[model samples]
Target: MTALAVRQIGPPRLTKGLESAGRLDWDAHRALHPHPRPLTTDQLIALCEAGSLHGRGGAAFPFARKVKATADSAVRRRKRTVVVVNGTEGEPGSAKDKTLLRGAPHLILDGAALAATALGSLEIIVAVTDPDAAASVQRAIAERGLGARARVVRLPERFITGEGGALVRGINGGRPIPPGRKSRASTRGVDGLPTLLSNAETYAQLAVLAGLGPHRYRKVGLPQEPGTVLLTVTGSARFPAVVETAAGAPLGHLLDLCGSRAGEGVLVGGYHGAWLKGEVATRTQVSRAGLAAAGGALGAGIVMPLGRGTCPLGECARVARYLAAESAGQCGPCRLGLPDLAGALTALASGQDAAAARDTVARAARMVTGRGACAHPDGTARFVLSAMDAFEDDIARHVADGGCGRPVLGVLPAATDARLSLEVDWSRCDGHGLCADVLRGTVRMDEYDYPVIPSEPIPARLEADARRAVAACPGLALRLVPRTAHDKPRPEPQRGR
Candidate 1:
C-alpha cells in the first residue's frame, strides 16, 4: 500500500504517456496512442506469434497460444469467451501490474477491449485487490464509455489470490483459492465460459503490439522475447522503484540504476523465486532464458537484493514462515509439509544443529514439491532451497559459531497481519501457566511459571487460540488489545515457586 517510484531504463513504451501524478485521462491516452484498427482473431494471433509477446504475470506463457486456445474453446463450446485482467498482485515483492493499473489504466483496458472484440466476447472483467487500482480502472472504464461491457471487481488480498485458477474462482463467486483439480482458464473460467485471463501488463503490451505491429514491436528487445519488461526493484536498494526496461537488459545495470551493489545476493521473481549469487546476478540478463541459465527465474519481475546488515538466513526463515502461514491448507503439502519446512529453516537460523536442520529442510522441501493443488508448495520449496545455497557461508558461520552477529533487519517484505496483541495484567495475576500452555508457540512460561508474553504482534492464525487463552484464564489476568496498547508498561511479576 506504499507509493512506488516509477522509472524507465530506456525508451518507454508501456509507460509512455504517464503524467506526473494521478491517472492519465482518456483524452491524453488517445493523443498518445490513437486506437488502431481492431485486429481480427487470426490477425491478433499472428501478430502475437510473430512478435513473441508472452504473459507478464510470472509464467511467461505465450499470448498467441492463449488467444488461439480461448478462441478455439469458445467456438467448440458455443459459449462466448470471457476476458479477465488480473491486477491482484498477491506477490508482495511485485508492483508492476498495480502500477500499470493506476498510471495507465486505459492502456490495459484498450488491450482487453481489443481482445474482447477480436474474440467476439461481450464481457471484460478487470479484477483488482488494491483499492487505488480498483478506483483507477473504474474511472477509466467510465471514461471510455465501456461501463456496460467492462467492469471492475475487487478481490481478497491474499498471496494465492493472483493465481490463474484462484482469480477466476474469485470472479465466479467462489472462495479465492486454487481449485482442487487443475483446469485451464481457457477451457472453463468466469461464468463457466471459456476465458482469456492475463496479467494487466500483458494486456497493455498487447495494446502496444496492436498499434505498433509485429515488426515495430520486435525492434526493442531480444529476437525471442521482444519489447520491454516492467520490474519491481526493491530491498537494500537506495531507490525502490517499478522500473521499465527492455528485455535482455543487463541485470547489473538495473541494480546500479536503483543504487544497489547486490550486498548479499539478489532475489529474483519474488518469494516463489530463486536467489542469485551477487556475482552471477551481476552477469545475468533480465530475461527468462538468461535467468534460467544462471540458476534463477524471471518470476513476476521482482528483484530484491539482501543487504549486508541483515542476516540472510534469518530473512529467509522469516519469509519461509510467512509462506507457511499463507498456505491455503487445501492439500497435504500445505497443511503439513510447509510448516515443517519453515520450522526447520527457523531452527537453522536460530543456531540449532546445522547438519540436521539442513537435512530436514531438504527432506521437507522434497516432500512438498509437486504435491500441492497449485505451485505454492513448489515455489516455497524453491525459495528456501535457493537461500540455503546462496547463503551457505553465513549458514556455516551460524553452525560453527553461534551466529553471523547480524540482526534480522527484515529488508525483504511479507504480508503480516499485526493488528492484535496479548496483554497480561500483572496486578491480578497468579503464576499460572495456562496462557503459555494454550498458546504454546507464542507464549512461554518463565522460571516461576508466570506467563512470558512476546512483544511481537500476534499472527492472524493464532488470534482464535489467543482469545480462548484469555477467556480460560482463572485469574482473568490476560486480554487481547490493539497492538499499540501492548507497549504500555505493566508491573513486574512477583517472583515465587
Candidate 2:
C-alpha cells in the first residue's frame, strides 16, 4: 500500500476507512472498472443525448455533442482515438478535480476507461498537477490493472496551464497555450487523432452509473443538476472544507457553510470568477446553475472566502493585473487588451474618476473583446467587470480617495510563475521618465504620475532594457527576484492587478 493510502483523515472514521464508503467497496474499486457497457455508435449517441450530460471541464459543453463529434471524426482516422481526463485544476481556488483524483481515483478511472471503450478507443490519459495527486492516481490505475489502458500524466504546476486547450498543448509537448482556431480536441488531440477530453470529476460521476444504474442515479439529483457535486470551500468562517452538496442546493445554506460577515466578500468562482458582496455571500447558494444564473459561473467548483481584513476592491484590482499577466500572449487582444484593463483598474483602485475608469474599460473591452484566439482576455475582463458591479461601494471609496485605509492583505493571487518583479516605489520615483523612455511598449508614463509596467514577462529583446530600468531607478525602488519571492501561494490565479 502507498504510504499515503487512507491517511490524513481528520475527524477520522475507521468505518468509512480513508475514503468515502458511499462510492464503492475498497476491493470492488480495485477490480477492473465497471463491466464495460459496450454500445453501438447510435446507441451511445442516444444515451448521451438522453442524459444531457455536459462537459464537466468548466465549459459545460454537451457531452452527447462532444461524443458525436469525436466518434464521427475518429471513425475513419488512422490514429487511434484517445480520451483525456483533465485533472489540472488550474483555477486559483478550485479543487474539485484534485479532490476526486486524490480521494476517488478509481472512480475517475472507471469513467475514463468506460468512455474510451464506448468511443471504441484504447488510449486513456489522466493529467494532474500535484505530486501527491499524481502518485495517488498512478497507484489507483495500477491497482485496478487499468494502467495498461490509461496513462497518468503529471503536468507543470501553473494555474492557467490546466485549461482545456493548454492541457492539449501540454500533452503535445508544447508550452500550455490556447490554439489559434477552432482546434477541437476531437480533431487534432494527442497527435492529430480524434479525442474526448473532460474534467476528472466528470469521470467519477460516470462511475456511479455502473453500480447505481441510470434510473437509480437519476433519483438523487434534480433534472438540471442531476448529480452530487463537490466544492472546495474557503472563507472567513471555519476550516477549509471540501463539501459535497446536491446540485442546485439553495445558496442560502451554502452561505451558512461559508458564513456571513460585513466588509468581507467571496470570490465566487476563482481568479476568473466574480466577487459576491457580503449580502450575496450571505444569501448565495452553491451550484453551477445557481451561480451561473446569478451572473457568475463557478469555474470548476472553486469558492474563496474573503476575510474581513483586506479591502475588497484593492484585493480585486491586485488580482486583475495578475490575471492579465498570466495571459498566454498567443492572442493579441488578451496580450494587449488585458494589460490595459488591468492598469485602468489599478488607477481606479488608487482613486481616479470612476466614470473615467469605466470609459477606459469600455475602450479596452472593445479592443480585446472578440479579438482573442482564446478566452483569456474575455474571461479576465468578465471578472473585472463583474467585480465593478458587485463591489460598487468599495470601488467608489477607493476611487474617491487616493488610498483605502485597509491594507492590501494579499488576499488575491499573483500571476508571475516565479515571483520576480521590477517594483517601483512611487515615493522614490520622481517621475524621471527614463524608465518609460527605455521600456516603451512594456512600461509607460501615467496621468497621475507613475511608471506603469505594461507587461510582466520581460521578452528577451526588452529584457536588457527592463534590467536597465531596474538599475536606473534612482530610488532603488526597482528590484527583481523570482515571482514567488514573497513566499506566499498566490490565490490560484488572482494575482495583483
Candidate 3:
C-alpha cells in the first residue's frame, strides 16, 4: 500500500488531526469533537435532508432517502434494523474512505451509533478491506465499549466488494461479489433484516452534521450540496494526497494544490468514470451537479489529471482492461461484454485498425449498458466512451499514423495481480488441447496438438479464460503463474493489414 499524504484545502473538519500522526485515540477524538446531543431518527433524517448529504460511495445516492427507506422497511417488516458501514474503498484511485477509517474511526462509529440508536437497531457492522482500517475500527469499538453492539468485519479486497448488496452478502458469509440481482439492502440484508448501509465517509459526515447541525454545516460548501468532501488526488499530482475541501471548490485549485499541470486530460471519479479535456477539467467544480454539467461525475471523489509523460490513450486502455478484469462475472454483460469492450479499447490504444477498433468499442459499450445485474458494465462503458470522446485527436493521429510517439508509462494505476501468464508441465502433458480451445486468443496448438503457451503475460480480457483453461486440462498440465521480470512483456495485438 502507498503511504497516503493527508491535506486540507479549507478549515479542516473530518481531517482535523489526521495529518499529525497515527490513529486518534478516543479521548483525543472527543476533545476535538465534543459529543453532541443524540439525534432522534427524525432529527437525523431531517439533518441529512437539509444538508443534502449524499453517500461518498460512487453512486452519490441521497443519504436521507436511504435512511428513511431502511427505517420504513424495518417498521413494515417487523424486524430489527441493521446498520452497516462500508469502508471497503475498492476504487484503485481513491483512498478517502481508508483515510477516514484509519485516522478517525471514532467519528464513523459516532455516526453509525447515532443511526443505530435512532433506528432502534442492536447491531452496527463495520466492513472494511484494509487491515489497518479494520484494526483501527476494532480498537475504536473496544474503546467506546461498543463490543456488544458494534463489530468490525474484514472483507476481501476486490473492486466491487464495496457495493451495498455485495457487502451485505459478504457479511452473511457468502462470496463478496454482486448477486447479479437487484435487491435493496434496506429490505433484505444481514440475516434477512432491514439494514441501513452507507459509505464510511457518509457516516462520518453524519457525525459532523450531528455536531454542527445543518445550518453551520451548510456554511462552508455550496448551498445546494452543503459541507465538505474528501477526494483522492492521483496521477500527475505532485502530492497524490487525500484532500478535504468544500464540496463546490474549483477543480483547478485542487489540481494546483496537488501540483498537477492537467497535462493531457483529467479523469474524474475512478475506473468507472469519465475523462474531461484539460481545459474542461480546470473549469469544472468538485460537486456532483458541477461535474455532471461538465460531462463527468464526482464518483467516489477521485480526481486524476493525466501527465504528459505517458500516452493518455494507453493509460485509459490500461484502466479499461483492469475494470473489465474486475467484473463480478455474474451477468453476461459483465462477463462477456466488458472483456470485449476492453479488448477493443486496447486495440485502439495500440494503434491497430483505429477506426474499426473505435467502432467496436462504441458498439460493445452500447451492448453492455443497463444489461448487467450491477452498474459495472454501465460504468465501464461510461469510462471507455468518455475516453473516446476526450482523446479524439490522439485517435485520429494513431489512425493516420501507426504510433503516438509516447511510451505507455502506465501512469494510471490498476491491480498488480493482473500481471499473470500461463505455464505448462510438459512432463505431465497428454497433448490435451483444452487450454488452446479455451484461451483461443493466447494459446495455440502445435502440429501434434500440444498446447503452445505464450511467454508474454496474458491479456486482461483472457485472464478468466486462462483460469478456466487451467482447470479444464485433463492431465492437469497447465497452471496460471505470476509474470516476473524475466517474462516477456505483453505483445500488442496485430495491426490491420
TM-score per prediction, in order, is 0.90, 0.83, 0.90
Which ranges of candidate 1 are over 4 A from the true structure? 19-21, 422-456, 465-481, 484-497
CA RMSD per model (angstroms)? 4.6, 5.3, 4.3
Q: Candidate 2, residue 389: CA error in Å?
A: 0.5
Candidate 3 local lDDT, 1-497, one digit each (tens): 46488988889999889986467889989998868677778987898898889988888889999999998998898889999999998898888999989989999998999999889997999999999999999999999998789999899888888988889989999988888788999999999999999999999998999899888989999888889989999987887999999988999999999989776689998888899999899999999999999999999899999987677777777777677767787888976787678767776766766778889889999999989899989999999899888888888877777557776765777663446878889999998788866764245555466765644467554677889998999999999887776643443332222
Q: Rank the candidates by TM-score, best first.
A: 1, 3, 2
Indicate whether candidate 1 or candidate 3 has the larger lDDT. 1
How does each model score on lDDT?
Answer: 0.85, 0.65, 0.84
Pick by lDDT: which candidate is best? Answer: 1
Q: Is candidate 2 or candidate 3 better by lDDT?
A: 3
lDDT, candidate 2, at 124: 90
Best by TM-score: 1
Off by over 4 Å in 2: 1-44, 235-237, 259-265, 281-284, 352-355, 423-430, 434-465, 471-477, 482-497
Tens digits of per-residue lDDT for model 1, 1-497: 57678888889898886525457879989888869678899998998898898998989999999999999999999999899999999987888888889989999998999999999986899999999999999999999898689989899888889999999999989998999788999999999999999999999999999889889899998988889999999989999889999999999999999999877699999998999999899999999999999999998999999888788887887788778767677999987788778877876775656667778989999999999999999999999999989988888887776567777766777655656878889997897788877765346554366776754456676678789899989999999888663353222211111
Model 3: pairs clashing at backbone N, Cα or C within 3 Å: none
Q: Write the per-residue lDDT of candidate 2 for residues 372-413, one digit (tens) a residue.
A: 887777778777877778777676565566445666656554
